[model samples]
Structures are given as C-alpha cells and as structure tokens.
Target: MSAPTGKALEEVRAKAQADVRALRKRVDHLDNDAIDLILRQARSHYAWTDKPVTDEIIHELYEITAGGPTSMNTCPARFVFVRSQEGKERLAKSLKPANVPKVMGAPVSVIIAHDLNFWTELPFLFPHEDRRPHFEGKAEHAEVTAFRNGTLQGGYFMIAARALGLDVGPISGFSNEIADAEFFAGTSLKSNFLCNIGYADETALFQKLPRFAFDQVCSFA
Candidate 1:
C-alpha cells in the first residue's frame, strides 16, 4: 500500500548493483558497446546445429523476464514454446520464405502472443484494485495497450535471453492468421512474433552493419 521504505530502496539498489556486476561478467563487459553488440548480434539466425533447449533454461528466462514492467503491471504477454513435431510443423507453415528455413532448423521456437482478454484477468495481476472494469467497455483501447505492453515484454525477454548466454533470432515474418488458427487455436492469445532460441555460430554471421549516431537520433533540446 505504501511506497518503498528507505531500507527497501537500499535493498533494491544493492540487488540491482549486484545484478549488474554479475551481468558484467556474463556479458563480456557492462558497457554500452557490449550492450549494442548483444542487441545487434541477436538477429535472425538461419543456421543451427542439433542441440536441444531444455525447459529448465526456458523457465529460467521466464523468471528473469517477469521483472520487466508492464502498464498497470498487467503483464499480458504469453509465450507458447513449439518443440513438438506437430507444433513446429504448424508454426513453420506460417513463416515467410526467408524465415521458414531458419525457424524450422532452430532447436526451439517460441511464439510471443498477447491475449485479447488479458484485462479480464487483471484482478489477480493488478490486485490493488479491480482494473478489469476500466477496460470492460474499452475494447479498442485495451487491444492497443495490451499489444504495446506485451511487445515491450517481448523485447525484455530477448535481452534477458542474451544476458543468460543464449542467442536469439526474433522474427515478425509470420502469418498471423494462419499461426493463430494452427498454433493458437482455442485460445484468446494472438501471435505477435516468433523467436528462435539457441547458441550462435560466430562463423555464420555476415559483416557488421552501420548504425546512426546518438546525435542523429536524439536531441538535448
């Protein structure tokens, strides 16, 4: 009910600093350049070996990702891991030609989805007050809010995965309609993106790409 106390704040600060220190070693250095490289290299990977991704590892990633903020703490994002032959086949059929092969070849692909009826469950997630009534008559607003927040959560998932020494290949070139029907059938969750998770082959990457300077993208005024 109340804001964080002084001790709570100190504890949070200590934990965050400790996390940064640990991540520094895991990420090769806790610098902006290292972060940029992590983001840049976490692109769509096409070639994969026959290694398997364990559910325990995925659960670990999920636990880390649960810390990402969402609007009203609604946390509307949902993920469906497609590991079975039938599930992968269904997911593969929905990818674009350029993405299909990579998705099919990856050890595991996760479908990041947003639930249309997520607000209805907010009573449990946002327990301070019943926020479901606020969204009851605002279908359009709810959809946009859920999509935007869930997308943010998905980005955090990728960053957390990278921090955990896993390579990510997130793609949007999949058929929403088909994927929804095939993989998300009987569910209110709608496909937002697909990401292949595994180790990266350093030899498989092409030349590095250029990026805009900070001045070009940001302004002090």
Candidate 2:
C-alpha cells in the first residue's frame, strides 16, 4: 500500500496517541474472549488445514512484531519465512523426525534467528550514545544479548500471528548447526527456533493442557 501522507499521516498518528491515552485511563482488563484469542485459548497447532497464508498477512505480522521492545532497541531478530517446498526440503534434514511432518504440512515455517553482530547497528537503532564499543570485542556478551533479545522477539512474533487470526507452532527440535548451514550460511545470523504458521486443523488439536497457579509460580521479593 502507498504510504499515508500529509493529513492522513497526521490523523493516523493522532488516533494512535489518543488510543494510548485512553488505555492509560482503563482499569478493567481485556474481556475473556479477547484474552483467549491471543493467549489462553491459543494452542500449539501441529496439524494444518489447506488454507494458505498470504504474503500480505506475513508483512502485517512483522509490522506488529517490530513494535515490541528490544534491549537498547537492538532488534536482533531476523526472520526467514520458509514457504516453498524446496525450502522445506532443505530444512527437513535439520528437524527431528517428529517435527518433520508438522513443518512439512504447514504452509509456512519461520526461521527465527539473531545476528551475532547486532551491536554494529546500535548507532542507527540507539543513537543517543556510542553503544557499539561496549560490545565490540565482547564476543560472549554479544552472543548472550543477541540470543536473549531474539528469543523475546520470537515470542512477540507468535503473539502477533495469533492476533492476526493465525495459529502458531514453535519448535526447537532441530540441529542449529545444520540450520545455520542451510539457511544462514555466509552470514553472522544464527538459528534460535522454528515456528510454523497457518490455520489449525481443529480435529487434530489436543485438549488444552493445565498451567501452574499464580501463587505456584510467583512470589514477592
């Protein structure tokens, strides 16, 4: 779509600012159904229907995910949407036997990865200070930061996909080495996880699993 300009851009920004102000005044939480759509009711779908996810939806998903916060705004996450049959085949050798079918059947499998040298872009993303020097020779620190923030972005990606009415199945049962060779070769990027996105086949869904109570998982300091 064409970029919104002049009065249109101003109106869009105004509406967004108004929404933020309105939310700050709200005390009530989201309704149960709305909550379920993004969290409680969303399932890790293993089976997919014949429906195809369009490129437009994928772009919209990124648009939403890109808004999520990252450490020092270092946004290290890089995505490879493996949609073609050839791409799936290339990925198959890296996946565990069990995850192979789920990935192959899905319309799209996303390779969620991080750039090892994400700090190099800090000048553009976090220009207030010279942050690149902090991580220039700190290889260990850079790797940890990249993995932590990139993994967080992956979570954002799933939430964004669900909000867009798509199901998500994130799996880590794969060889990182092989995946790096197949997808990130000749690059500083490294694989973190894989997520399959598509419409879920309800008939194949398992019963919702239970979760720990709030008290069981949290305590005041």
TM-scores for every candidate against the unseen true structure: 0.82, 0.89
| RMSD (CA, Å), each prediction | 4.5, 4.9
Against the reference, the lDDT scores of all candidates come to: 0.83, 0.94
**Which has the greatest TM-score?**
2
Residue-by-residue lDDT tens digits, candidate 1, 104-161: 7788888999998899877677765777887888989888988999899899988988
Backbone collision count in every prediction?
A: 0, 0
Model 2 weakest lDDT span, ten residues long = 1-10
User: Backbone clash tally for model 1?
Assistant: 0
Deviating ranges (above 4 Å) for candidate 1: 1-37, 40-44
Query: Which stretches of model 2 miss by more than 4 angstroms?
Result: 1-19, 22-29
Error of 2 at 150 (Å): 0.3
lDDT of 2 at 197: 98
